[model samples]
Target: METVKRVLVTPEAKKVIDQLSKQHGKLMFHQSGGCCDGSSPMCFKEGTFRIGSSDVRLGEIAGCPFYMSRSQFEYWKHTQLTVDVVKGRGASFSLEIPLGVRFVIRSRLFTEEEFARLEPIQNG
Candidate 1:
């Protein structure tokens, strides 16, 4: 059965994305394994990761574009996010959090470049 869930941006995450977007850059996030288990998805977006009442706002972190993750996108896709009912808007889809895996939201949506970036990593 198909499912739909929404995503809400955390206040702290919003701050980080906002600062990065202003610099003008692209947010790149990766999930890696380690002993200490730095499980929280890492934030490496160059530009802003902004969050508005409707869309996730990105300012400019390092002169690049920022974005979000598949899982994060999925959460938001399904409407799992908490935003003003009349203000915020997120993509609606069903995304499952992979087992023993962490994700990052570099920005809000996926683009051709980001898709290409992720393909290699996933295949490798």
Candidate 2:
């Protein structure tokens, strides 16, 4: 994928990434944005992030690794964030943060149909 911001995925997410890497040969990160808040870094199976035109670059967070678009990196530069995994019931990836920050949960990456449903909220 294109280079973007550098971000870190939590250790909980590492297990999933390890599995995905096995299945897909490897896994990388990619994040986008929401309207009201700053750009949200997310994980992508395999994608492109062009700097300048883009914003984020792939990197590590806390200790775990993730991808961030170039724009997102610059926008979120010097910002400290929390990343964790929430399981049980309908388990989800939670980007523990202050108001206005967001991250793409794992479920949304599965399909465009499902992603579209949440697009309004993410984009709004």
Q: Which candidate has the top score in lDDT?
A: 2
Q: Total clashes, candidate 2?
A: 24
Worst 10 residues of 1 by lDDT: 92-101
After superposition, the stretches of candidate 1 with alpha carbons farther than 4 Å from their true spots are: 1-8, 46-124
lDDT of 2 by residue, 10-86 (tens): 66756555654565553444444555433344443443323344443334543334544455545544443444444
Candidate 1, 20-112: lDDT as tens digits: 445534453322222342323334542223333333322222232223444444343322222111122222211112122223333244444
Backbone atom clashes (below 3 Å) for every candidate: 55, 24
The Cα RMSD in angstroms, rounded to one decimal, for candidate 2 relative to the true structure is 14.4
Model 1 residue 47 CA deviation in Å = 12
In model 2, what is the error at residue 83, expressed in angstroms?
A: 3.7
Best-performing candidate as measured by TM-score:
2
> In candidate 1, residue 42 scores what lDDT?
36
